[model samples]
Target: MRFRMALYPLLGDLKTICLTLAYLYGLTVYDASYLALGKLLSGDVYTADGKSSKRRRGAK
Candidate 1:
């Protein structure tokens, strides 16, 4: 199967969400942004950073 990727511009609301996630999760804004986008699209988030992944899972 082929997966297509699209670019999304982060607007004000997304930036705010990312900031909040970063604060709540103790993740960098960059990592939180990925989480925010996953929440927005109702999609799963995959990461190579085990520590961050553990933190995300623990929050749930």
Candidate 2:
């Protein structure tokens, strides 16, 4: 009975850790995707449809 009682809290903690890890993994994946999209659609690289005419380094 005592062991079972102790196991309950341990199981709860394990579940919390698993959920936290899943959340962090999701956040990491989302961050990577956001950066990839930002790079892909960034300034005059793929199109001239940008909203600004700002100059970049080493540009004429």
Q: Which candidate is the best by TM-score?
A: 1
lDDT value, residue 57 of candidate 2: 16
User: What are the RMSDs of all candidates, in order?
Assistant: 2.0, 19.9
Best by lDDT: 1
lDDT per residue (tens digit) for residues 20-59 in model 1: 8889889888888888888877888888898889777743
Query: In model 2, which runs have C-alpha deviations exceeding 4 angstroms?
Result: 1-10, 27-60
lDDT of 2 by residue, 19-58 (tens): 4443544433323333234334462333242332132111
TM agreement with the true structure for every prediction:
0.78, 0.25
User: Ten consecutive residues with minimal summed lDDT in candidate 1?
Assistant: 51-60
- Score each candidate by Cα lDDT: 0.81, 0.33
Give the residue spans of candidate 1 off by over 4 A. Answer: 1-3, 58-60
The residue-level lDDT of candidate 1 at 5 comes to 92
